[model samples]
Target: MPHPILTDLETIASSTAAENGFDLCGVKVFTHLKPMTMQVQIRHIGGGDVSLEECASFSAPMGEAIETSQLLNEAYVLEISSPGIDDQLVNDRDFQTFRGFPIEVAYRNDQGSELRQAGLLHKRSTDHVHLNIKGKINRILRKDVIAVHLTRLKG
Candidate 1:
């Protein structure tokens, strides 16, 4: 279970992202560091890539919201960024946005053996991920998936 403070921070960050026409992709808090660190990832809500300028544009409002909420009593570094192109696909929005794009899925089979497969993303369902490999659609159980990532294949 995540800490309540982390959840509250996520709520504030998410709301700030939405207000700025972006979607909150992820939030991570690192308490072990000297001053602590909070990293927030955001992406364009319209499915476009997030640019450096956009990250800068979001930083002000995000920082203001966090400071206004008074959720963190201690000093912490707030890092705002975009999930890079090669980052793993971990959310439904990513699956939808990258539909038909080339991807690689790393998973474990029923025998508990690790395996990797590359294909075009077909769709992701509640229980499985559908991939189009060489004109055939293959379904991989969600439980077995270790990671799914966008990939670029050299021609």
Candidate 2:
């Protein structure tokens, strides 16, 4: 059988994302924007966080990449920007990068309820992240993490 031509929307969207300088592009599941819009977070090695200015800056080129791809020609909303404050923390690397900052993490606890904990990001190993909760610390395995993020603590 002839190899099937790759026509999955995700594959095309990912390609467009890379061409537009996005380190990662994933299918955002929730659509209601009930809390916030799921986003495409871009991480540039050695580059600083994607600022609002940068997002606006890349708008034209990013749109061009998506438009030229010929993948989705309809009026599908193309959001070109940085990962916002409400975005989820994905892994140990994310913890490592945001170390020393306050973070909110969602993970399954011993009881299996989705638990949300906030603390200072302490350390990251290959498989776990160390969080300093108040003065005490706890190491959480990566697999248990449903989400994590740097949170600003207002005094």
Q: Find the candidate with the highest TM-score and give its number.
A: 1
Predicted model with the maximum lDDT: 1
How does candidate 1 fare on TM-score?
A: 0.76
| Residue range 40-91, candidate 2, lDDT tens digits | 4455434457777766666566556556766543354545565556566665
Residue 114 lDDT in candidate 1: 96
Candidate 1: lDDT over CA atoms?
A: 0.91
Instruction: Please give each candidate's TM-score.
Output: 0.76, 0.70
Q: How many residue pairs clash per model? A: 0, 0
The global Cα lDDT (0 to 1) of model 2 is 0.63
How many times do residue backbones clash in model 2? Answer: 0
Q: State each model's CA lDDT, in order.
A: 0.91, 0.63
Model 2, poorest ten-residue lDDT window? 1-10
lDDT per residue for candidate 1 within 12-73, as digits (tens), equals: 99999999999998899988886989999998888788898989888999999999999888
Off by over 4 Å in 2: 1-10, 13-17, 20-22, 25-39, 51-53
Off by over 4 Å in 1: 1-4, 106-108, 111-116, 125-127, 133-136, 151-155
